[model samples]
Target: MSEIHGSYDMGPSVLSPENVAPKTAEVQDLERILRGEISAVEAYKQVLEKYSTYENANSLRRILVEHEKAVDFWKKQLRSQESFVEESSGPWGTVVETFVGAAKLFGDGPTLRALKEGEEHGLNEYQDLIENGNVNFESESFIKTICLDQQRLHIATLDSLIMMNKV
Candidate 1:
């Protein structure tokens, strides 16, 4: 099994994948952004591996790069600042895990549709985060921008699913 700390030496911890659902609205917003970062990163990797065309591959790569960078930026912000409350249940985490399971029982189109739906849910969660003062103004702005970018990518993925699967 893979290690949680991004290393092989650490034994795989049985910790439940984090849910970014915060109790407070502000913290909830940050959690949604955090969860998006996680989901986009994973989807980026999956798309990169699953597709072959230069255009499609590069599209996924760009999305992955941006989201990965955002993840790094948020991690840094979390380290430097205070006031954000972390969450235990996040839409991104749950959706991605659910997608993994769905892949087994559903066609690629269905799976992609499910992921797109999850992405939409995640976008809504982030919206709630922003409207609720779940984060500072600057942090909120930054995460909101990232969430928007993820939305565009999610839309693209949805289109790709329809094109590929006739869905």
Candidate 2:
């Protein structure tokens, strides 16, 4: 119901130089992961749009929609929390943008493979972030479960696509 800001503003104090100091590598990784989630959703959308006429268009669309849902969930949570920090240098966005451009140039086969690889990288990143003590972010178990599923599904999807000569 409320308008979403990129991050919650508890007060100006939170933005003070000392309070907003650079984050540790682990926290930076969490920020990167969050950015990657958004990027993945964007990449998936680009893929669905690019391959709307492909044989498995509907499946692609389903995956893209699901990813969009996940992106929104994380964005909403990050915006709601006061302590959420934005990265000074956003590597995830660059990575996603490059992948999307590649997807646009290549056909569905290679694009999907690239996406699967990205998802695999994301899975490892999320696992590492979850294990990092500096981040200490607590999300719903459902989110964790969904992240795990995305990782596994990406691997399976890549394997099936390769086997079927779809990608």
Candidate 3:
């Protein structure tokens, strides 16, 4: 059997195991980020609906637009790489959403705080990926952009919370 790249079997082979390994790893990392973005979208939507009458409702809505953009970007990246895009937030995100729903019972302030914490968590996750070189070079730019956006959202959420307190 002929070999390519000194590792791939080129005879009667339908798939290259060596090539598939790295690609699968990259896809899995990107999918994790995509899932986080999906969770962010859901969390922001819940906050918007629960606090529709709050003074900063419009601000929260604007932040949701950012999360939506990230979601779209990650989904596109996954599709381009021929990866299966995850549509749900998974178990942990479900628990967080449940807590967010409960937080709404207290007040908009608490809900906003919870969202701020979530954004901070996302920012750290992205930073970890970038710092640890978990993302491939081609995907680094997208990950960095998402990290910056998460930072902005976290700061905005904090600002909104502070402003709400002053009211």
Candidate 4:
């Protein structure tokens, strides 16, 4: 765990009963982020099914792959820590699907808008963890650098795609 924490006491209090019941706050937080990434993957799949032949399918697929990579990265890390990763995206995934599903009825532009909003929500989640999460040094660095960067790129990509889709 020292490698994960990057040389430290590993934040002893992070494992206190109050801080850890089913799991430590840090692990719980990571799982929550993981679920969001999973939800992103699902939502993209839904959109891709509806937009399979649309001009932006390639862009959506690229973003979907990025989301999938995040999910895989977190799943492996959590498994290595002996933590259980949620098999489903959980409730949050359902909510994302609902929104995107409805948007699909409105048209491709609306669907892209919904996805952009979802990506923004995901970006906000990463920012919140950076500012408020009790994760170790390495985890924080990972979120601040890689995670946040990816979120920004995803959102920007969605924004560009949305504009292209607009008349």
TM-scores of all models?
Answer: 0.61, 0.69, 0.77, 0.82
- The residue-level lDDT of candidate 1 at 47 comes to 46
Residue-level lDDT for 144 in candidate 4: 80
For candidate 2, write residues 91-166 as lDDT tens digits: 7667776876776686656777787787788778767666764443455353477877867786787667656656
TM-score of model 1 (CA atoms): 0.61
lDDT of 1: 0.60
Write the residue-wise lDDT of candidate 3 on 70-118 in tens digits: 8888878877775656778788679779989997888756776778788
Question: Candidate 4, residues 3-23: lDDT per residue as tens digits?
Answer: 464566655533233433478
State the local distance difference test value for candidate 2. Answer: 0.64
Instruction: Report each candidate's C-alpha RMSD, comma-separated, in the order given.
Output: 10.6, 8.3, 7.0, 9.5
User: Residue-wise lDDT of candidate 1 within 1-167, one digit each (tens)?
Assistant: 96577546654343222532235554444555676677767755654455545444555566567767767766555544443433323565666766745563665566556556656766676677667675777787775676666776767776785686633
Candidate numbers, best TM-score first, in rank order: 4, 3, 2, 1
Residue 147 Cα positional deviation in candidate 2, in Å, after optimal superposition: 0.9
Candidate 4 Cα errors over 4 Å, as ranges: 1-21
Query: What residue pairs are clashing in model 2?
Result: none
Position 96, candidate 2: lDDT: 72
- Candidate 2 ranges beyond 4 A from true positions: 1-29, 83-91, 134-137
